[model samples]
Target: MLSQPFNPLPLDELTAVFARIKDLLLTQDKVDRALEVLVQAVGDAIPGSAGAGISLFDAHGRGSSIAATALVVEQADAAQHDLGQGPCLAAWTAGTTVLIHDAATDARWPLWSEAVASLPVRSLVSTPLAAAGGPIGTLKVYASLPAAYTSATGQLLEKFAVPAATLLAHIQGPGTPRHLSGPLKGALAGRDTTNRACGMLMERDGLTAEQAFHELLRRARTSGAPLSRVCSDLVDGRA
Candidate 1:
């Protein structure tokens, strides 16, 4: 007979877990380190998660493993990049979450599904990292058992996604010569919005970085708006 599904964590314990994650994000100064911590937190917080990872897209939209709780997670991400389609990529492009109950039988991404069949992963959930400009990447949890993630697990992960996005945006933004303190960090976060907006345009329209900036400039000029405002609109999809 098959074993029972994993039980969800207690509400109070879940809250405490998130509190610790918040502290982790606040204390981390580097993006890479922050992502490493974030993935570890996911593995710790979610029930039945064998591993967790962050898959980031470069300026050119090439996906790669940024961080992972284990080597299995990294290899899983690499398999998706190799196949050129997977739940994580779908989540990033659609700006929503994607769940696979069992990769061995999932037909949505046939190539990716077949490729990962030999791995320990059976079920997975990929949630988009919604930054100020748009979705920059995905946070994914891998499970060695089928039907591993439940509604409660998904909800918990969703709650974590918000601050995860902000922390990631701050890390991807331009860095100061010295460690930022006080209001400078907030100001830099705002600037990163524009930078991310430009990146989105470049990825979407196949424009060079300079061309992307000019496009933003052209839009702002024609619409009689500030560059930052135009970028914010683009980032938030008002443009």
Candidate 2:
């Protein structure tokens, strides 16, 4: 519910912005780095944005802030995760865009709003990162001014969502390119399996996302096996 009137970017400017993003995407070597850069791009592309962050949900729906332009953005996302509420989490879980004109006066998530009210953030917008199955994460931009985001801003962000989700899925999915070295391919597979295992643990045992990840690492060490193998075994119910 932004109070400000929507200001659409001129077609030429919007085209150039996307062109720059395409170049940035090509330069990224890793999914994590790509997501970080994408959030930075969002901050740069949109007016009135102070910072940006990516909120990723594991398969079990537990949210974690993967990247942020500033410490305040990270803190704000963390508050939402800790409280089990916030626009980012809502966007990810519900697969919809969310906007908070002013967190201090936004009554939908009172606890989350109150918690982050002390921070420098005033307005926020979160868009769902839709994957093949559904939304797997959220892309969020924070502003220090109230009513900073408008309908045009939301539309612009929606255009970026597809590419962002695709990049993440490419890294985590099983279809590694044949050009990658054997070791590198194995490393990516291991990371993806570990993430899946962590998600499974969270859902089955009601553990927090961080706790589940640590548990996987500890079990892998105790079993004297590669983390990937351990995760695979867990997924197959063999461990």
Candidate 3:
């Protein structure tokens, strides 16, 4: 969609949209909420986008789903995890936007295309969620039909990228840790899996928390295993 001839946008209009974002951020409860707004803003900025979602990576290189407008985010996440390729992954890895106006015909990620075809999706665009250290994740947009997103839309998404990163940084700060579920709930947050694995290792081997964690990592590297798998093995007494 972005293949068309370029047309310049006026500065006043750009500043106006940014000012509105500033106002929304001020009223938001936290950085995550602000990022939701930022994702929605990307949709509003683009003409054909039906929805948007944001994901962020932790210190462990694991990316978690944050906020999403619909099931498209879930599909996108699955595609990235399963196929290990897609706009979102590329955006995060390269710290740059990856825009694909048509997924069905795209050769970049054939497995991703086949997997996502069943979903009500077509065009997709991803902008790197970056900070001082580099990319943490992606801000992804989805359209219901092919060739819907344009280069202009990609640029607009880029404009909001910094603010999205800032909000994510705030949410993932010293005070807030990423949890998959709430405290009252049995759901695990960011370090929950790691904690559980450490506990299991400790119980099985009489090691300290730090020692167990290091052991898990050491075994994972030595055995060429995934940390999550090592954790599971410890939990299930299979390691």
Candidate 4:
């Protein structure tokens, strides 16, 4: 329905919107309730967005929490998990943004596209929810119309993802870990991953142990990402 260029909220207004989400984070006691409200606000706030969803995943990429503004969106996300391929999962695993202009006409994930063809889910943008060490999952917004989201929309969504993820990282509720779904646990896992990544850098470039570590630091600094995230990218062969 929307063919015009997408103009997202101004930076100041957008910050105010996310500030509200942050406030919700502090007021609510239940993670699920806060998540639902947050998702609904997100869907309503973004122009042309039919729905919004947030999915949290463990280190192994299994979902730990999932919330959506509408049932159709819930089903759409479930299809991604069931089919094992979709924009959100791609964003989560790759620690990058995934934007699909039209799932109906041109789908990079043909299987998932076919699965959700009957639903009002065509254009969407998903961004990895990056935290202290690495991405914890993804936050996505969906639109019913083809080409509903433009490149600018994707960029805005990425900007929105940063603070959104920050609030989510601090959410507390029943069965929710106080930090990053268990910061200590994630840190321990990150340590192992970091060690293996250091080894990979050492072997790949024939650098000394300290030199390899410095290289990892350099990558983290240049990329403006966390060291553990840099290590994860290298270990996952994405760096």
Clashing pairs in 4: none
Q: For residues 3-88, what per-residue lDDT tens digits would candidate 3 score against the true structure?
A: 44434345465556556666655664354555555666667666666788887655343566777877777777767755555668
lDDT of 4 by residue, 71-142 (tens): 777888888767656777677655678888889876467899999999998899988878776677788899
Tell me the RMSD of model 4 versus the true structure. Answer: 8.6
- Number of backbone-clashing residue pairs for each candidate, in the order shown: 0, 0, 5, 0
After the best TM-score superposition of candidate 4, give how far the Cα of residue 52 lies from its true spot, in angstroms. Answer: 0.5
Candidate 4 lDDT score relative to the true structure: 0.72
Q: TM-score of each candidate?
A: 0.65, 0.65, 0.65, 0.71
Off by over 4 Å in 3: 1-28, 172-177, 180-239
Return the candidate ranking by lDDT, descending: 4, 2, 1, 3
lDDT of 4 at 132: 76
Q: Give me candidate 1's TM-score against the actual structure.
A: 0.65
> lDDT tens string, model 2, 6-112?
55566576556556655655664444555566777788778778898877665333467777998989999999877767788767645678888889898878889
Judge candidate 1 against the unseen true structure and give its global Cα lDDT, from 0 to 1: 0.70
Distance from true location, Cα of 167 in model 1, Å: 0.4
Q: Whose lDDT is higher: candidate 2's or candidate 4's?
A: 4
Q: lDDT of candidate 2?
A: 0.71
In order, candidate lDDTs are 0.70, 0.71, 0.65, 0.72
